[model samples]
Target chain A: MTGTAYVKKIRSGEARLWPSRRPPLTRLDIELTERCNNDCIHCSVNRPAGDREARAREWGAESWKKLLDEAAALGCLVVRLTGGEPLLRDDFGEIYIHARRLGLRVMIFTNAALMTPGLARLLKDMPPLEAVEVSVYGMKEHTYEAVTRTPGSFDAFRRGLGLLREHGVPFIVKGAVLPATRGEMDEFEAWAAGLPGAAGLPSYALLFDLRSRRDGRKNALISSLRTDADEFVRVSRRHGEEAVGEWRDFCARSGGGRGGRLFSCLPSGGSAAVDPYGRLQYCLGLRHPATVYDLAAGSLREAVTEFLPAVRDMRSAGPAYLERCGRCFLKGLCEQCPAKSWAEHGTLDTPVEYFCGIAHAQAVAAGLLEPGEKAWAVTDEAARTKRRR
Target chain B: MSDKIDLDRIYAPSEDIVVREIEGEIVIVPLVSGIGDMEDELFTLNETGRDIWNKIDGSRTVAAVIRELAEEYEAPAGLLEGDVAGLLEELLVRKMVVEKE
Candidate 1:
């Protein structure tokens, strides 16, 4: 009763602060189910939707409610429910309502094809969601289906969008850059801006990362469609200098993280992600077992208190991370991190040259580095300040 | 460490900081710095520090705050004064607190 009343106060903005007048963990990202109907060529982690065994392995609605209750007790205020497609689960309504009852502001991430009339109504009737981020693959039917590889997915996506609009449920549209949708990227953003609740332009991901599970499966087709570092920088520069200006402002305040571990920037050292298998990780792509804690085996209390801290304490493995990424001040401008390293090279410390190339290209474009300057080989005494421990 | 803290000035939390209560502790986020800068550092205040923070509402002098805390906790006023002064100095260095004009 005491905790329930406290949650009520938090929802009404009466007592948002913990008793110590501090907040506990604020956000929990749950990957509901990895089973995606769309077979996008550059897909990073979608196990085929036909895998019944994988679907069976995911934690059910009641378990999720228990976890949400536990999270509320720990002072979690936000829950981001994301997946290959979160709406694939039948118990989505139950889980969503449960999180709301616990006073968490829920954010949903979905491909939008699975969003049905019933779900839209449920979202409308429930308290307004914090955010519902919808992924748009293309501007037309053929282009959309080409990326999703599902023949009628374009129609379903449109229907989903229609339902959200009809119900007046607020949502934002984001796009993935693919060969099929490359030509329509501008049109897509323009249309997204004109949508019901879209704020500015749609944010996009250029470089498609590999599978984080390190499961040894490779998609050469997706790799061929990658927007190279130069193109990424050129496109970014064409947009505006605001991005680079912000990066510079950030670097000025915090010189750079101590170069060793990749996950040091987490909020108050607690922001975490959980996969469909109930494995809690340091972040979305960090699936290394040594760092991943199984919530099914132990309570959320153990995962938060013991396992998370231990994972945070883990050191960088190889010499490259220690020498280059550790001492490098370009983390603000670079995509170098343990998760990306693990995805590209199947090891935590191995450098992903794609990211290095992108960062160098961006550096040159932003006037932070020379035209031919190599990011990894930056030996300039003035540029490469020692990382603060 | 026998120096003095000016007792005449008014002190308060910084304008650009987000004060969060997490896990029975107070965390201060330097918004314009770490957040916009994408830096990963956050400041967490301990128990006595939290108590002192509760009193720094822009209306209290350093001496008044120290005296009030001392009376409330039944501790020596001199010790509380020294602790509050040192805490304020650190907060100033971190830019989490400012001397009000």
Candidate 2:
């Protein structure tokens, strides 16, 4: 009976061996809304802030709290409050305080454009449970407002930071280099370093991928902001050998043998996310309804027990998946996932060539793969899958 | 946790906190009441603080840690005592360290 027990490996210590079972769900990421005060060209998930028709179907505050209750009962310990801007919600305080009271540690992801004095005070008065991730677009107003496309957003951000400072609440400032903010790279890094919590926080984004939602007609804007595959990998190369070494270590303990499942990752087993309209999906970037468990119609328990098992047990089904993504041995390094695939092409199985190019470039640069080796091919696994098919 | 923690109180690190040594600094993450942040969820201890945190093995008293650090660094015992007391006070309030047997 114990011939082959599934093992869960943690960092720096012993790996816990478990019998094959449902993945333990510990964190819940609730996208409070898809609305944002900013209209950044690189954004993948924002609708216009005042688009009333778009928000008509969104769940109200009560529904959100009820979902939080359900999530808490599901053994979720931390609830990440994120969005186009989580601060855009008027009832954010009520929802945040409720989560805290329910014993859920709340982590807020915000743009700082709407962080008011009252909000900062409320957060500071409470015990420092987690970090507030404030997105910093540009150090200067002209550049910043260009990215946000809002006239007074920079002032709001400055005011928000001021409020946090006045109350002595520490936050981490992070940024992504879009076309509009690229020239301010040095200015951004220097400013981020000057922050109180800058020493141990993420301060930049590397390899910004294509729009996760594809945003239909709005894809043009995101693509315009996105650099080419070569440029993306060039930025990623800065991490150098550390990234390669980390990937090597990850694969060894990940339970993925030469021909293991493409996504034999703990994330699919251990975590789940809920989008704005009460649909429970596997991750923040995935919006596949067929794969989602509807929280509005069912309990989290049912979702975990029934829906997640099916999701976890999901196998590659098509010829394309078997050829490229399923058989790829760059398991740790590749960014190809169902979420990325779905976001790029509306299919779970198709490999996004752009991601492949980036992965191959990294592999070549890091000496993991030969410079001319096929980016989308794992020779041995490809042959194995071909025979099996 | 009183504003004045007794000098002789034996304290130990909380089981709820996860301490990891990353890139030289010791990072303490409160995992019991909250989820650790991917970017900034940890409270890192400086070299001195890490040494103190490591010596808190539930068997040692506050004064013991102070004496050990003072001797180890050849610093004044009186100064070390003040620093340790201040740090312990903050940690106690945050519930990262608690009085033990």
Candidate 3:
């Protein structure tokens, strides 16, 4: 009989098939490489795309495949392939196919500069489950090139995006808010809104982080590009009351106090990040020497089960942190996590003043705090509520 | 088209798909061209369908699977044969299953 003759008896649909018991490890972020084709001014983790030494230090496809096998065995269902730009690696397709073969949904973070017809066709044939997230520097060539610093990267990015669209591969674009790209925000938003599968307003990276490697020169450039608290507030207001409402809800849930513990936001052991050199970290931005677990010397299971838990349970003893961020009700609303603190100050617990200013500005805008009033200084809840009203 | 069951013909799962038992449900993800025309790119089976799937070892003939399934459930031989044939045929159309050489 023909295949069509028996079609009516079978039942099939897109349904949730996960077991009731949550997997110990559900998500993994694999940084394929720290190298990128473009040198964006605001980037914190970019190396020269052709840095021979950096390329030599990276694990081969087989090593990455082995990690995927281990991660899959531990019940990882999703793996995000991110990097300075993941497409810089020649073996990206092999690594990607291996992950897909293991039934892990892949989410790619790319600048779209290296997207080729072959890559787009491959993605179209075997979907990544999550949309390929492309970072857009600017809508115009001059503004885009200024941020990326690569002379012809704008055309390359557009060509890459075109390849994705041409092959019917799903993807989305995000922007970096910089002095160079700020003027083109309206243009960027309009263009993004017109793209196929565009969902909601496009997101922008407002708060730029210092270099992960602690390169002083790059950090200086990154700091110079960051918008001040007032500018951040102004740029964020583009979302209007929806953003304010989110902050209000966040405060109501996560406000209050964080005692001495530094990892209140981290889940027990659900997720992990593996860097280019196979060094596993609890979170991506947390590259503090003490917190990084060398995967080459150990296994993913050891890092996930033994090492990450210990790192998460670490508490802060810094007086500056205890006095400011510890008792602050804006702890939930603030981006003053150990990762940000590490990236900014080389310490895990020290509060970054830039993040503090942005958080306080948000609190004031949300009516959760009065202007010039520090969230930590508010001792009386009743008085604070009275001021909020 | 043959009305009679192929008692000696064996069938197996396709290499171009990933079969996973998630949360007690069987999920099949097609590696090429997406999964069974589903927008979400996943194909799932019910309890009975999963039972049939479990018995589709490459070494087992269609008649053997039907016989095993028949003994497990309180069903007639004719009914089991139809059920197994229908499911296999549908899977074949989707390229989720292939006939063994």
Query: How much lDDT does candidate 2 score?
Result: 0.68
What are the Cα lDDT values of the candidates?
0.72, 0.68, 0.82
Instruction: Give the 10-residue window scoring lowest on summed lDDT in candidate 1 chain A.
Output: A1-10
Chain B TM-score, all predictions listed = 0.86, 0.82, 0.86
Instruction: Tell me candidate 2's fraction of native contacts, as a decimal between 0 and 1.
Output: 0.01
Candidate 2 ranges beyond 4 A from true positions = A1-24, A209-213, A238-241, A247-262, A375-389, B1-101
Q: Is candidate 1 or candidate 3 better by lDDT?
A: 3
Clashing pairs in 1: A21-B21, A22-B20, A22-B21, A22-B22, A23-B21, A23-B22, A24-B22, A250-B37, A259-A326
lDDT of 3 by residue, A177-259 (tens): 99988888888899999998998888989999888788999999999989999988888888677787777777777757787
Computed on C-alphas against the true complex, the DockQ of each candidate is: 0.05, 0.04, 0.31
lDDT of 1 by residue, A19-96 (tens): 444444677899998888788877777778778999989999888899988887777766889887888888988998
Candidate 2: tens digits of C-alpha lDDT, residues B3-73: 47676889987866655443344546554443333322446554556667788879888788878888888
For candidate 1, the per-residue lDDT at A143 reads 92
Model 3 residue A141 CA deviation (Å) reads 1.2
Best by lDDT: 3
How far residue A213's Cα lies from its native spot in candidate 1, in Å, is: 2.0
Where model 3 places Cα greater than 4 Å from the true spot, the runs are: A1-20, A379-389, B1-11, B22-27, B37-40, B43-49, B58-67, B73-95, B98-101
Candidate 3, residue A54: lDDT: 89
**Model 1: what is its DockQ?**
0.05
Instruction: Evaluate residue A293 in candidate 3 and report its C-alpha lDDT on the 0 to 100 scale.
Output: 98
